[model samples]
Target: MARAYGFVEYGGPETQQLFDTPVPSPGPGQLLVAVRAAGVNPADWKVRSGRRTGSVTVHFPAVLGREVAGVVEAAGPDTGFRPGDAVFGATAEGYGGYAEYTLVDARAAALVPESAPFEVAATLPVAAGTAFDIVEHLEIVDADTVLVLGAGGGVGSATTQLAHAAGAAVLGVTSAGKRELVESCGGMWIESGDGFDARVAATAERCGAVTAVVDLVGGDVLERAVALTRAPERVVSVADPARAEELGGSGITRRRTREVFEHVAALVERGVLTPRVERTFPLTEAGAALELVESGHAGGKIVVTVP
Candidate 1:
């Protein structure tokens, strides 16, 4: 039996617990992986809390975690992976990454680059992957001015770096504590709070007109961000699609492909992007890792490591 963390019902942190289960067997186009690291994202808890119930119907005793990096333990028919290959990507639905072993869809999976560590590769599937898609969708240019809301977090930080690498001037809205982190990634920091639009406008005057915004924070923040850009179509929100639609914008549409994974790995290898994993918790302490991500205060990415 493999040790794993999961929830028996839809609820809060209390719903998550550790248990023993038989190691999952991979079917066609799947791989059973000995998990080395798992990424913690707000979406994991959103699903656990039933916030996405209308869109996602999960069974009871659902394993919780979207992406993982590990060594392939077994491969199913039609999969390119073989035993002992180091790979990272999305986990199979219901059999997730917060465990000793999990199944990954071969189409969503890719081999980790030689220079990347398991922890860094672990962060790619969800956050970095979305960030890559967002940048591509925005079609940012060298003369464009980009604004990133909640820019200190995983997706936000990745967006900032990718935008900067594209030669766009990035203005990152974040807490005062993350100023250095945002600046280090070639973005200017804008304090997150009231009057965010005014600040964005002022920064645009100094840099260039705000051409696009990547919203990781939803609701009022996204509403304010819409005004900073030239057109609502240039404004995109990863956090709230409903509100974005109301404002003539839209949420990020992810294009998860092996090539997308390869692009992010290439960025890291070339030093154009960095996967900043702020902290790691042991698999037994997975609950603590989720708590940190759900609190909305942690910077960079939070990862769970299985020893």
Candidate 2:
């Protein structure tokens, strides 16, 4: 039996437990992989908490991870990957990658470059993929100024770097503690708080009117960010779709494919973007790693390694 960390019920951290799971078989267009690393994100806990009702089907004894970097163990019919190929991708079934073995859709999987390590590859699927989607949707241009809310976290950090690489000036909103981290990614840090809009406006006037706002922080913060843009439609959120719609913006519409994964990987290869992996935990300590993300104190990506 393959060991895995997961939850038997929808609840808080107390619900998480380690258990033995059968090594999953690959479905058509999928690859069964021996997982080396998995990335942890807020969505893992949000779904685990039962707060994101109906967004996904939760099978009890659910393995809880989305992204993985691993060696292929088997390839399903029509998949191009071979056994022993080094690859990374989003889990074909969202709840599987927390296990020692999981399946990744061929369409979402990519060959890992020789220069990229498993931990770095693990960070791309959700955070960098989502960042790419958000930036692509905005179609940010040279001379544009884009403001990223919650810029210290994984997605925000990737967004900052990718936008900066596209020749746009990046203004990042994050806590004071993360100012250096955000700035290091070529983003101008704006401390998040009350009157952040005025600060954004002042910054924009000095550069140019904010052309786009990428909201990784939702609710009221997102609502306020919409005003910083010249048009609400230029504001998009990954956090709050409902609030975004009310403000005339919308949430990111993701295109999950191997092509997208390869593009983000290429950015990493080119040194145009970097995945800031702050900490890694063994599979046994998956709960603690997730707790740090849930606490909202994590400075960057948190990864779980499989033995």
Candidate 3:
């Protein structure tokens, strides 16, 4: 039996528990992976709380997590992976990364570069992948000024780095504690909170107008970001798609493919992108890890490592 953490029902953190289960078997186009690491995200908790069940239906005792990295233990037909091959990608539907073993769709999986560790590779499929989609969708250019709300978080930090690498000026809106982190990621730090829009406007005066806004924090924050840019079409929200659409902006549409994963992994290998893993918890501490991400204050990414 393999150890796993998951929710027994649709509810709060109280619904989560650790238990033992048989190692999952992979079917056609799937790979059973010995999960070395898993990246924690806000979406995990959202799904657990039943706030985001439209996309994926949860079974009772549903495991949590979407991205993972590890060595393949077995491969199903047409998967093209063998035992001991290092790989990472999104978990298969109804499967979760927060376990000793999980299944990944081969089409969405990529070989982990020798230079990239499992922890770093584990972060790509979701956070870095979403950032990539946002940058590509906006077609960020050197002349453009990009504003990243919640810049200190995983996706925000990745987006900031990618936009900066594309020669765009990046303004990262984050809490005061993450000023150093935002600046280190090649962004000009703009503190979030009351007068956030004013502060962003003041910075824009010096750095040029924000040509695009990447909203990782939605609701009023997204409203403020939309107002900062004249091209509302360039505004994209990963948090609240409905609100973004109402404001004339669209939501990020992910390209969850192996090619995208390979590209992001290559960036990590070349040191062009850093996963910036803030902390790692053991499998037993997965609950705390999710709580940190759900709190919306985690800097960079939180990973759960398995022994």
Give the candidate number with the greatest TM-score. Answer: 3
> Candidate 2 at 288: error in angstroms?
0.5
Q: Give the TM-score of candidate 1.
A: 0.98
Model 2 stretches astray by more than 4 angstroms: none
For each candidate, give its TM-score against the true structure: 0.98, 0.97, 0.98
Computed on alpha carbons, the lDDT of every model, listed in order, comes to 0.90, 0.90, 0.93
Better of 2 and 3 by lDDT: 3
Which of the two candidates, 2 or 3, achieves a greater TM-score against the reference? 3
| Cα lDDT tens digits for candidate 3, 68-118 | 999999999999889999999999999999999999999999999788889
Worst 10 residues of 3 by lDDT: 52-61
Q: Model 3: residues >4 Å from true position, as ranges? A: none
Clashes of each: 0, 0, 0
> Between 1 and 3, whose TM-score is larger?
3
Which regions of candidate 1 are displaced past 4 Å?
Answer: none
19 Cα displacement, candidate 3 (Å): 0.7
lDDT against true structure, model 2: 0.90
lDDT of 2 by residue, 2-72 (tens): 99999989888899999998888888999999999999999999989998667766778999988999999
